[model samples]
Target: MIVLPYLQTPRARIRLAEASDAPMLLRYREENHAHLSPWEPLREPEYYTLAHCLKTITEGREYALQDRGYPLMAFDPDEQTILATFTFANVVRGVFQGCHLGYGVAERMQGHGLMREILEPGIAWAFGELGLHRVMANYLPRNERSAKLLAKLGFEREGYARRYLRIAGVWEDHVLTARICPDG
Candidate 1:
């Protein structure tokens, strides 16, 4: 597993969410509940509670220890506000050095290139520090924003996964994409 670092970007910092950040994490979920519903799984209102946030952060730490994954949060540099989360999940080491990517940006943080800022170093750390050779991401076909970001990050659109993901409780189609570290 990789030791999480505070990644500096032009507009934000990306780092691991701490137990102390439970309140802010809960706030992120609450504020983006409606705005993220379409793209995210249906969450109960209380799913964003402090207790849940604390448990999730603790779980993330455990997962990192098992080399299962790393969960990262993006924050506004000036105010130190959590703005988004970027996750590298399903990590497979040994010969199959790879992982899957998942993310969500706070509604207010959208359109300011925060996604790219967080992803650039995140992906680098995946390859450089975690010894990953490939990273994959998938998105609903109608999610133009996600598709664009994957492409912008040099991920190739591999194919469509027919009814592959159960999102919002429905099996939905997704465009599969991947990026291989050239230097790996």
Candidate 2:
């Protein structure tokens, strides 16, 4: 649909969500709940509800407008089903013009190179149109998929943090990685 400027892949079109897209987000959340639980924060029962998804979508849109971040959805050609979600969050400017990258793919779309397809341009937009210098992404040490993906995307290993983030319930260690703007 070309809704988002300068964001697309061969298999997916990346765009921010509209309020009406809440249903799609809800469906994606529900379908991938079990699949993504290990990597994400614990979700309360209400988090799966339509109203909550709508609220989240609204907040995400607000964040985008504020230059904070946005939940970029990678949708198939139909644009009805979500392929993946890439969020560039916690934007900090001034000397450190950077943000955090978080993402997840649909259960069915895993192992199909869909995430890379989405992120390649997503990061490019972050560094180009957004005019950011650095983009950081971290992952649980055991998440081999993430480790491989980040390495493939040229995110150099910066360091490791103990008890970095609370995933599911307990604190988990993370391997921090970052990519700088190539043109800089």
Instruction: Please report the candidate that would top TM-score against the real structure.
Output: 2
> What is the RMSD, in Å, between candidate 1 and the native fold over all Cα?
1.3
lDDT of 1 by residue, 43-118 (tens): 7756878999999999998888888989988887863578889899999978889999999999997888889888
Candidate 1 to truth, TM: 0.95
TM-score per model over all chains: 0.95, 0.96
The segments of candidate 2 whose C-alpha lies over 4 angstroms from its true place after superposition are 1-6
lDDT score of residue 18 within candidate 2: 85
The worst-scoring run of ten residues by lDDT in candidate 1 lies at 1-10
Q: Estimate the overall C-alpha local distance difference test score of candidate 1.
A: 0.88
Please report, in order, the local distance difference test score of every candidate based on alpha carbons: 0.88, 0.90
Q: Quote the lDDT for 170 in model 2.
A: 96
